[model samples]
Target chain A: MLEFLERIGWFVGLVLVQVLVLSHVHIYGYATPFLYIFFVLSLNSGIDRNILLIWAFAIGLTVDIFCNTPGMHTAAITLVAFLRQPILKGVVIKEVEEEFEPCISTMGFFPYLKYTLLCTLIFCSVVEMIDTFSFFDLKELGLKIITDTLITLVCIFCVEAVFRRDKSEERF
Target chain B: MRNLLDFLIKYKHWLLFIFLEVISFVLLFRFNGYQGSVFFTSANVVTGKVYQMTNNLTGYFHLKTINSDLVQHNAELSIQLEHLKEAYKKLTADTTVIEQMKQEALMDCRLIKANVINNSTIHANNFITIDKGEADGVQKEMGVVSGSGIVGIVYQTSAHYAVIIPVLNSKSSISCKIRRSDYFGFLKWEGGSPEFAYIKDMPRHSIFEVGDTIVTSGHSAIFPSGVLVGTVDDVGDSNDGLSYSIRVKLFTDFARLNEVRVIERSNIEEQLELEESVVNKER
Candidate 1:
């Protein structure tokens, strides 16, 4: 019950931070770090995939509502949630524990970093591609996707570091 | 049936994913297909309120700049007022024609002040939201202009806010003319830099040069005659080469725009009715 409330709190907090704060940060007129993806990324592996997908869609739509981007956010985030399992399967874990949440402290530094990097890249690509919606400015789209992905990764890393939990706090 | 039910249960997540994606795609296509659908747009009540609140917070930061702009405009208006008084005195002393003064008073437009609450320039179809709306006497299709120059026409309005299809949008084409000559063209914003726009359909023989001033022609009742639009920075041949397309540097710096006035042209319906009657008679 406490965990559920915490998840709810984290979701709202991330959305507020994303819409009010991060959306204003337009660096070099290209990248806007979508740190709200951290909410999706930090969900426990033990959580039901169905719930995860729903949560992802809801959060993405919420972000869209704030930014006035109709369906772009929902589409990109739903893509990430759909592919999260496939991506996770490819990442080999030596000692898999039940209900282990993926974080730098829980999953080790490099593995967690790789996980976030892959998710952010895929998410950012879908967003920028759908936004431009044509190949006319592929160069601009590519630059925006890459820059935004890197900046989002950096932001997510900082957030994870600040909110890092001790091993005792792990669910399993 | 039991086997099918089991299969459905097993692949429920995949089904859910596909369903959500299809919904998102529907929304995407629906919105992009229709340019001015205000239902899901930021001009909606809830989002409009949030943007207004955010603008209220951030507007304070721009107070000094806005004040300076207002002061400059006031000085210019005062000088124009003085000139107008001198002209009136000279005309009265010479001919005693009250008809000229009455004709000048016949201008039916009124300016309502408003602040831009939200705006976007990155999109091909950019929109600007102003603080005034229906309750504030702002109606759809009304012209919005900054102190510097033409901004756009009102696209949609809620109870408390209104959205503008500004000069940056591809759909925006304002009738404008050369200040020196009667040669006219339609101003168009092709994708790219926001500082520049193109004026197409000017005749090849039209007498024009770089640095020529362009202003609203008053051909469309949206904007009155001689409102400062832009200045021709480059003169080039049109795509067909039969006519000329002039690149203009717009007077209004949209990136720095904070305040504007919504032009309410009174008696537009009566004029439209008269024009419609003339068209009917011609037919």
Candidate 2:
């Protein structure tokens, strides 16, 4: 019960930060890093795919409401959520087929970084592409995608470090 | 039937994904406008409250600059007031001229002050949210201007908050012209620096130079005539090479936008009705 509540709190916290704070930070006038994908990344692997999709939709809608982008965030984040399982399967090793969260502690450092980077790339590309909704300027879109993905990856790396539990600090 | 049920169960997640994406696409294409349903937009109550809270937290940092700006504007207003008083006294001596001026004053508008609660300048289609809303007489199509220059048009308004599609958005286009020669162009932002926007479709023969001033042409009912927009920084040929596409340095620093005045034209409805009648007659 406590774990469930903690997870819910973390989700809300991320959405709040993304909407109220990070959305306002447009680094160098183009790269607005969206770090809320960390919520989708940190969810337990055992959770149902259907449930995951709903959660993704909910977070995306929350962000879209604040940013006034209508359905763009929803479409992009839902794509990330939908692609999460397949991407995870492709990245993870066969031996560690357990139902742990995709944090640095659960997945080894290299595998976790790879997983986060791939997901961030997919999510950022979807978002930037849908934002234009047309082939207006491919170069600008490419710049936005690459820069935003890199920024989001840096944020996710910071989050991974912050959330990593020390052995002495672990309750178990 | 059993096989169908089994298939349905197997593909439920995929179905859900498709369902959500469909809803998103519908919202994207259908309700993307500022006048679209404001229920899901930032102008809505819950989101508005969140943005307002964040604004309150960050607003304190901008107090020094905002105060100085207010003082400067106050001084300018006092000077204008003195000039207007002298003009009024002179005009009153000529009753016929005073009557004509009064008749023109009937078309005068009012300004409602609002603070910028949230703004984004980096997106291709950026939006700005202000603290004023429908209750504050802020309606869609109303012009928003800072003390410096025109800010944007009020796109959506809720009971207590409103969102503006500023000059920074790629989707934004405001009708403006050269102040010296009345050669008009449509001002558009092509997404680089927020400080500059491009004016398209200026006549190739029109003579212009850098530092030339551009102001609203009043062709659109949204903004008044001769309102300052920007100054020409660079002039170049349009993509088709037929017309001039001039770059303008906007006066409103959208990043430092703290307050704005929403302009409400008193006879807008009547003017729109008249225009509509003309179109109807032509059709």
Candidate 3:
């Protein structure tokens, strides 16, 4: 119960930081890193594909409502949440996977970094691309993808670095 | 029956997720004009108490600004009172020419305070998360403008939070007309630049000049007429004759956006009812 409440608190905090502080941050004309995905990432490994999709849908829909997309984020987040299992299956070896949640610390040093970087980069790119609908020129599309991916990667790296934690600290 | 059971067994989780999402979509389509009021409106004691706490938090921040505005307003009122007294005495001695200022005096604007929670800017169609939700008095189609300028529209609201689609996103388009010529066009983001959006469907015959102001046309219920949208940067005609491609520099700096106002018309219900009746009669 405490852990559940703790997760809720964490979600709330991410939301606040995203809106109050992060929303104000723009790099090279692109703003908002969408670190809120961390909420879904932080969920335990045993989560079912169905529940994860719903969670992603709920979260995405929540974001969608706030942003007013026709169902864009919902579609993207749902895709990633559905894809999370397969992606993790490829990245996390069976032995280390038992030890921790999916992040730089839990999945082991190098594996965690690789996993977080790859997952977040993919997630942000796909969401942004879908949201934009492969607009006018290929150059603009490429630029948006690269820029979005870079910011997302850098953000994840910085956040993971600053809030350095060991596997044991997360399991609560 | 057997096939149905098999399908259900195969995709129960997907079905469940779809069910919730459909519910969300329904809420989005159903509500209009200030869903935030619903939370504060409910007679339920629990919701009322929760809103009270949230309102208290908002009040703590708003007091100083509100107080200063009232103080200046009070000073203005005192001067007006003296003038009114003098006018009262003159009514018996002279003809009164002061016509009642009704429409122009009531410039409709309301400030809605909502906490920012989950927001995305990188997405092609971005969303802003606010602590205010359906229960608070926010509704879909109500204009969401930040301190900077026109922000976006309220898309969805839960019990405690609402989302806005900012102008930077491609999906948002409002009918805007050049202030100088009064020639109208549709303003849409091309999703290329943050500072610019394209105005489509303007004919080549129309004039296109630099630094012309653009404002919303009150053609739709979304915004009142003459809300400052942006300025025309450049205009070009297409090879074909359909429309001109004009670029606009948006007035709102979406990057620095915070705090928005939701504009609700007083006669929205009447307008909606009249439209619905017309449609029904046509049917």
Q: Give the per-residue lDDT digits (tens) of candidate 2, residues B136-202.
A: 8899989999989989998888899998989988778899999999999899888778899999799
Ranking by lDDT: 2, 1, 3
Model 1 C-alpha lDDT versus the unseen true structure: 0.84
A24-76: candidate 2 lDDT, tens digit per residue: 77777567779999999889888899999999999998889888888999999
Q: Write the residue-wise lDDT of candidate 1 on B124-153 in tens digits.
A: 667788888899999988889998999999
Q: Cα deviation in Å at residue B115, candidate 1?
A: 2.0
Predicted candidate 3 versus true structure: per-residue lDDT over A69-158, tens digit per residue? 435556656666766776777777665435346766567767666665666667766665655563655665666667666666677667
Model 3 misplaced regions, further than 4 Å = A1-20, A39-78, A92-108, A134-137, A158-172, B1-123, B126-173, B216-227, B257-283
The reply for model 1, stretches above 4 Å from the true place, is A95-97, A165-172, B1-3, B35-39, B91-106, B240-242, B270-283
lDDT of 3 by residue, B106-205 (tens): 5454556764444455545565656676677777777876544477777655566666766766667788787788888777776656788888788767
Q: If you superpose only chain B onto the true chain B, what TM-score does each candidate give?
A: 0.86, 0.88, 0.62
Candidate 1, residue A150: lDDT: 92
- Per-residue CA lDDT of candidate 1, range A79-158, in tens? 99888876765663674756677787667788887889999999999988876663248788889899999999999988
Fraction of true contacts retained by every candidate, in order, equals 0.50, 0.82, 0.20
Question: Candidate 3 at B172: error in angstroms?
Answer: 4.1
**Candidate 3 residue B16 C-alpha distance from true site, Å:** 7.7
Residue B27 miss distance in model 1 (angstroms): 2.0
DockQ of 3: 0.28
Best by TM-score: 2
